[model samples]
Target: MPHFNSAHTQVFQNGELTLGLMTPFGDATHDLADMEDQFRLAAMADELGFKALWVRDVPLMVPQGSANTASNLDDPFIWLAGIAGVTKRIALGTAAAVLTLRNPIHLAKTALSMDRLSKGRFILGLGSGDRPAEFAAFNEDPETRAAVYREHWKLLRSALSSSDEQRSVLRSATGGFDLMSKPASDIPMIVVGTSRQSLQWIAEHADAWATYHREDARQQGRIGLWRLSLEQKGASLNKPFIQSIQLELSSDPDTATEPLELGLRTGRNGLNRYLAGLKTMGVSHVILNLTLKQRNAGEIIEEIGQYVIPRFPP
Candidate 1:
């Protein structure tokens, strides 16, 4: 198999945890996000040496559910493509692309095009999707999604093969044509959550793991579980583990951490200490979601770049 491209290797280095910024890049207090501001935030993150920038794949805006609640208002691929053009080196990724909703051939081709356009700097984070309304809208069976997920995953893997021989091994689903534009090298694929599959299945197939962030103690246990699962198959888990969290920066340098939705509210000092603990617990990358912050998004990014990021330098 071909190795992952330079951006993947750089962001997921062994024995070190790097930071990434999730898009919409603003406080959650609002309903709308500006496109120019989003682009500017991505550029700043790249300039500040953040390892990656993540965008969510939300195909439909659910009526009153969480989808309609937040400011994630763009197609992840189109948005990431815009960011890729302006940024020089920051890795671009779909926090996850919902594999169940998209055709595998389409997913594979679009991903390859993005990787080529970005010069080998795309990470394909994938998931089975959690929204029931979406499944209904697409006329897919939510109950049988696990089977669909597995089948489509196999198709995508076959379609995106870096070797021409491997590409030819599987005939197109229609048995009528050959897929084109294999990635320049393997695009790193991070399986998100279980995607309704077993741990062994994920460990065997994924290049990395991107799961939800949790308290340090619980997260360590989760990583331990993954390691044990891989070990049971007589294999070592050499791949990185990644997580995404919400962040709220307080002005006081010594402010204590308080509980929030997916993350915590804390000062830069507290944030640094917290991230250091996560790194020590075996997390390889932390994707920061700036949704619930009270400070100006730009200022918070700058402060993190100046203070917190130096402690966990990429």
Candidate 2:
């Protein structure tokens, strides 16, 4: 495998935890209308020393439930390209792009193009996809998504490989079409969720692993499992672990934490301590989704940038 790209190294240092922001930051219903403001805040985050900016891939507005009602989301590649134009250094990534639903050739081309456009600051996060409606729309059977995921993953990896041996193998298998463009460096592939695979599979194939937020003890246990998987696979134990959280920052800097569904409502101090604990437990990065209902997103970002990020420098 190729070495870590610039973005991967910047965001996933072993024994350290870095912070990133989730893009399209506002109430889901209003995200499309808030694009200009979103870019402005994205630029602000870049300046404020955040490590990366992540965007989601929601191909259709499939309402999964009351909590997961689809929002108008921009295509992850296009959105990240726009963000790349606005920011200089902060890494740009997909929280995950659905691998089973996209053609591997196109996906590899787009990822390489984005990596070039971002000047080597792109990370490719992949998922097997979870929504049955999305699978049906793509004329795929969700029942076989796991097998599809593995197949697509192999094809995508072969397409993206810089190794001459790998490239030759890919060409022989595909009967000889070239990818045409090359990445600035290796593009990091982080497996988001299980993608219907075992921990051992992820540990063997992924550059890193990304998962959702959980309680501290549960998260620690998950990290333990990840470590054990890496050990069992003879992979690097330093391979990073990532998690995302929905944050509602309180006005008072010292306010105590209150748990939300997959995140927390907390002040700067509480947030700092929580992130510190994550670092100790082996989390390499945390993506913050600012669920701002009562404060300006910029204000909360600025607060986190000033008070929280400084303590956990990338």
Candidate 3:
């Protein structure tokens, strides 16, 4: 097993699909996660042997977009911090944090703080900003976002590594400085999407690759593409692939898969089969969003724990 961090070890099992829960545990009837209940759900997930608990960085809401726009109204760092206090064992991750919108120094400090709080369970997933509102509001040029993304990544990596011989300096958009409190363990970074960078760049930088769920054959193609990119770069094949899916689990164990918003409505049997397919395609982790479910979050989680989890056994 890789010894980088608890999160890395928990997520990658060589040939298995480790399950994770995305925050705001239940269905979102009000366009927001139930903040009151989220703490409880997070604790349950941790206690129930879930591999990870994922959160997203939605700094601002773009009101003019689709109906699926987020309204959770919580900071990712704050939420993860709270969950860290309440839970043990389950890895805490950012489904992704928008690196282009924040100061790299502050991001590094905050990420290290969270890693410390969680005892090295933090996975700092990064992405180039996608929303126009976010880019405009932050005065960041979208065309140069990819370059900025790479710069931020390089600075963070340097900040986190040991430089006992000499101090490490990081240059940001405005100024240059050294970040403090490097994490005790290497915080695993998983790049979400292409982030307007090449696969070769991703292979060179990211500890893992995280992408949206695709159909089986297409997903396999992506896995093949990732492996080929790594092979070309002489990179380690130990890098894991992560994918997220929205789930609406059914009561009937034999329920067939039906399309839903960015995921599927399926029973445990169907969910197991889908996960098995992903595992076979070299996917190491599956972060499941329960924000579109028809069943109770606790009930669904309990059922998954009882049946599906044993089959995968993260």
Candidate 4:
């Protein structure tokens, strides 16, 4: 809300269409042992002309939750670094990192190192943790997650941006300043969820705002809130309104209105219609998750690259 370019304007000036993969790590259908599948798929995404690759900071997944079977995975930072050496054209970003569960200083070190390794291609996504089980195992409380989350995000930002004189007070540093290289700039940080964070807070401190599974009809009002918050703060941002959606483009083109957690269970027609509505609602980018597909990730990728992206917002 303070001062940043909206992701919408930034995206339009650059390229707007983006694709997110929930890394097919534990799929029993294929050889799940391929640890590098994420990297390989990321590279393939870039080669196939995708804009960015989204990774996540998932440590523990709720087995019965909507994400129950989806998360047979690890920390996203590891995956980010693994693919950094290979990916060139596509920017790397996170869906959201559970900051409340990590040591602030350590997390900062990882963020800086990943950005440096990627040559300023990293976008840090952070969120308040909602998983009580994860909080319990780590000796954290769900109620205090917001506080911890803010504290860690601020600490990480300060560490990444501080000079030697400013950082001298921390008792310890990862790798003693030289262990992990620093990124070229203050790597952009994005906020995940509403998080009880005010518009003034977001406009003043955040680089972008991320929402999940918003209905098509509601895009305008949602993005308008973000924009109004930015305007009210008297801040200028090169920020954009970014949202993630789930889609199932079946073999049939007609839309199917079915029940879904954060997205629609629709075919190509509904998918396009929804996306078109988003474009009109002033959304700059949408990270599509094809986890609802009846087919494999490779097949899903092909379907999108050939059919969906070609018609993205101008």
The window of 10 residues in a row where model 2 has the poorest summed lDDT is 26-35
> Scored by CA lDDT, what does every candidate get?
0.82, 0.88, 0.81, 0.65
TM-score pick, better of 2 and 4: 2
TM-score of 1: 0.93
lDDT of 1: 0.82
Q: Could you tell me the lDDT of residue 262 within candidate 3?
A: 70
Best candidate, TM-score = 2
Per-model TM-score versus the true fold: 0.93, 0.97, 0.92, 0.82
Task: State residue 264's C-alpha deviation in candidate 2, in Å.
Answer: 0.8
219, model 1: CA deviation in Å?
1.2
- Scanning candidate 3 in windows of ten residues, the lowest lDDT window is 165-174
Estimate, for each residue in 196-221, the C-alpha lDDT of model 4 and write its tens digit. 57767877777778888765557677
Better candidate by lDDT, 3 or 4 = 3
**Candidate 2 at residue 119, lDDT?**
84
Candidate 3, 214-314: lDDT as tens digits = 77788899999999999988899878888999888999999999877578889899999999888887899998987443678899998888898898874
For residue 251, what is the lDDT in candidate 4? 67
* Per-prediction CA RMSD (Å): 2.1, 1.3, 2.6, 4.2
lDDT of 1 by residue, 29-123 (tens): 35657888878888998888898998888777655444556333678898889999899989999888999999988888898888888998998
